[model samples]
Target: MCKAWDRNMYKLRFIISFQVQLIINFKLIAICSHQIFL
Candidate 1:
């Protein structure tokens, strides 16, 4: 049971970090597009 719980925690952390990276990437793209338009 403890091992299962630890695995789930790790998965959750991985997902959170992945989401943050995706958000940063999207923001960077948006900024680049805006600069191009300007």
Candidate 2:
């Protein structure tokens, strides 16, 4: 039971980090596009 809980925690952390990375990438693209427009 402890092992299963630990595995779930790890999976949650992985998903959160992946989402943060995706948001960062999207912001970078937006900034680049804004610069191009200017």
Candidate 3:
């Protein structure tokens, strides 16, 4: 039971971190596009 719980926690953490990275990437892309247009 303990091992399963640890695995789930790790998976959840990974998913959250991955999502954060994606958001940062999108923000960077938006900034670059805005600069190019200006």
Candidate 4:
């Protein structure tokens, strides 16, 4: 049971980190597009 719980926690951490990276990438793209428009 403990091992299963640890695995779930690890998976959750990975998903959270992945989402953060995606958000940062999106922000960068938006800034670049805005600069081009300006």
Instruction: Report lDDT (CA) for all predictions.
Output: 1.00, 1.00, 1.00, 1.00
Model 3: lowest-lDDT 10 consecutive positions: 1-10
Tens digit of lDDT per residue, candidate 4, span 1-38?
A: 99999999999999999999999999999999999999
RMSD of each: 0.4, 0.5, 0.4, 0.5
Superposed model 1: Cα runs more than 4 Å off? none
What lDDT tens digits, residue by residue, belong to model 3 across residues 1-38? 99999999999999999999999999999999999999
Backbone clash pairs for candidate 4 read none
TM-score of each: 0.94, 0.94, 0.94, 0.93
Which residue pairs overlap in candidate 3's backbone?
none
Cα RMSD, model 4: 0.5
Q: Give me the overall lDDT of model 2.
A: 1.00
